[model samples]
Target: MLSPFDAHIDAELAQAVATIAHLRRALEETSTPGEAEEVLDLFEKLLRDLERVKPTVIGRTRQHGASWDAVGRSIGMNKDAARKKYNTNNVQRALARIQDGRPATPHPQRAPVHP
Candidate 1:
């Protein structure tokens, strides 16, 4: 499934698109190279912002209800692609131990096993 970073990137991509649209409108109204360049730079920064957030989604995609399918939807990912990329993607090693058809929530009293 899609990761947390993937989810975040999905959200950021929408924001980036909106930001670009706004800048485009502004550019058409003003038609200044300097201003256009400035907006383009901001666009680049948003792209970088997207880059930074994708990894966070990727790192947090598995847990309880945080299944691959859920992760993929959050990140606008196709199910097959998300599965292909992250099927073996491990989230919490501790969670793996309790995978015998058990609930995934962790209780502090029930200490996690050290691998």
Candidate 2:
């Protein structure tokens, strides 16, 4: 089983990815500013938490991000675990790309639309 720190890092990374995905989708569809702000808030928090976790690895936990799966699976995670972990890095990169006015991945969960 992976240590608590590893698990914590993986969770934080996953949340970051999912949040980014959502925000990206919202921007593409011209979502309302209020909804976009909500996702942005969550995304910002995830980024901050990720920076905190990045330096928490004290030993073999320092392996590449690919190692996040085994750590997650040991804690009952599923296939999305791996994809989600890598997406964390991808999320940040994609965000940068979008900020630079480039295309990014379409998010599966976009912010709710109002009538």
Candidate 3:
């Protein structure tokens, strides 16, 4: 059984997915340039939000013993790609958080096992 926190997160994710689907359909059906641009703007905002959240989520996963290979598998990418894409941003953001006196995600206590 899912914990309450997990359930709430799952529900929110589902709702967000549903909303995205609705927006995609509306975008596809748009006939006028202005309407299409409006839909595209909303889509761009969603993409921006995802970009902002991605590094933090990656950092959280690392703190919780997730490996780059595992995370890559989950997202359909290779570990090298994952690192190349996010590691610098992750380090920079973490440093900024620390400098700001905020508790950033903790680093893994042990190195990940290699296969």
Candidate 4:
């Protein structure tokens, strides 16, 4: 059975795919430079949004007990590449927060240490 997180990811990816298809059709049907530019801008924004969500999705998947190999397969990468890209201290902390039943926001900055 798919987890709730998996279902959410599926829904998001489906929406993104549909939006991209619509943008592609719009781009193809554009009669004026301004319309094409608008479509391009929307596409850029969608790309940015996907980039922002990718790490969070990966972190959540890892938190749900997925292995790096599984993540890599899902994303069309190798295990080492997936680990190198998504395995960061921030991601780890976020996963920790999720496991701890807290919101997965960034931890506050620490004060400098003195010798």
Candidate 5:
């Protein structure tokens, strides 16, 4: 069965696509290479930030009740891949923090995943 988190992810992805489309339009209207380059650089930075935060986002979503299946569909993967990639030791630490009533720390962008 489909999960509600999948719907949320779909909506977010749609919004992201719309935002990128608008950015592309603005980029095409830039009159100078310098201006276009600046926009391009910012766009690339945004993508990098998104990639960096993806694992944290997925972990937090799971903490808040999203299933791996939903997360996998959201990112175009399967359940096992999603958990294998995102639910590493860092996530466990974060989850423990929440359970122990401590503020969550910023997780490293990636952690070693164990079988």
Candidate 6:
């Protein structure tokens, strides 16, 4: 079953693909260079939007109990690479919370000690 976040990502990707296809058709049909340029600019903007969302999606996937290895595999990377790239911001945020005297969210639970 797809998680809600996963489903959302899938939907967004589908929409982006549709938009890209429309833009491609528009580009092919354009009679003027200016129109083609406009379509290309739209494509660039769409790419930028996708780039901006990537880290947020990765972070949220981790929060949703995805392992670094899983994330890496999904993105065609290795576990260490994924963690190094995506975990830095999370670490910085946690440090900021600690500095401000607020406990970081989703604190790890310790196992009970038994005699």
Give the TM-score ranking, best first.
6, 4, 5, 3, 1, 2
Estimated TM-score for each candidate:
0.41, 0.39, 0.51, 0.55, 0.52, 0.56
Off by over 4 Å in 5: 1-29, 90-115
Judge candidate 6 at residue 92 and give its lDDT. Answer: 52
Better of 1 and 3 by lDDT: 3
- The residue pairs in collision within model 3 are none
Clashing pairs in 2: none
Ten residues in sequence with the least summed lDDT for candidate 2: 54-63
> Across residues 19-61, which tens digit of lDDT does each residue of candidate 6 receive?
7887888888888766666676667656754654466578667
Instruction: Count clashes in each candidate, considering only residues at least 3 apart in sequence or on different chains.
Output: 9, 0, 0, 0, 0, 0
Model 1, 31-112: lDDT tens digits are 6666666566656655665554444445554534476677788778976777665554433321243234342333333232
TM-score between model 1 and native: 0.41
* TM-score quality measure for candidate 3: 0.51
Clashes of 4: 0
Q: What is the lDDT of candidate 6?
A: 0.68
Tell me the lDDT of model 2 at 84. Answer: 62
Per-model lDDT: 0.55, 0.54, 0.62, 0.71, 0.64, 0.68
- Show model 3 residue runs off by greater than 4 Å: 1-32, 88-115
Write down the TM-score for model 5: 0.52
Please identify which of the two predictions, 2 or 6, would achieve the higher TM-score against the true structure: 6
C-alpha root-mean-square deviation, candidate 4: 11.0
Report the C-alpha lDDT of model 2 over 2-114, residue by residue, as the tens digit: 55446555665787788788767766765677766666666665566555444333222434544555655653666476446434455456445535655444334445555
7-89: candidate 5 lDDT, tens digit per residue: 43454466567658767886878997666765665576446545644655686688679988999999999999888878768
Regions more than 4 Å wrong, model 6: 1-29, 88-115
